[model samples]
Target: MANTTSAKKATRKIARKTAINKARRTRVRGCLRKVEEAIAAADQAAASEALRIAQSELMRAVSKGVFHKNTASRKVSRLSKRIKALSA
Candidate 1:
């Protein structure tokens, strides 16, 4: 349905970006889930480590434009707070 060559190229670029963004989102969710699981299990060390990983993933996603920087920061802050509370 793309009527122009440029439109076809744009479609291709969008598809590739979509796939990449999806992968980044999936990875961030997994990392967040791992941190949540560790917190639920009351493993402070594991939770801390997982949070660290999740925070890094979030930051990376933000830098890559998959997520807003403030959004990532808020997520990291909330997760870290929960993790800290679990340790206390």
Candidate 2:
């Protein structure tokens, strides 16, 4: 119920941004899932590779404002720790 023209335009802009951010979030989740799957399967090499890709996707999301930098960093750190533990 946006009566003002500017308000209508803002609503449209918000919808567009929502769609884009949703896609980005989905992509990031997919990457994280891949890493987790690799880890669960205990495949060190695959986990490492997946983590590499996930790390980049996470940072990309952070840059796009889909995720906070610290959140992404924490995810990357935890994944790295798990991957390293596989070596032991």
Task: Find the 10 residues in a row with the least total lDDT in model 2.
Answer: 79-88
lDDT scores for all predictions? 0.93, 0.96
Q: Each candidate's TM vs. the true structure?
A: 0.96, 0.98
lDDT per residue for candidate 1 within 12-84, as digits (tens), equals 9999999999999999999999998998899989999999999999999999999999999999999889878
lDDT of 1 at 18: 100
lDDT of 2: 0.96
RMSD of each: 0.7, 0.5
User: How far out, in Å, is residue 5 in model 2?
Assistant: 0.7
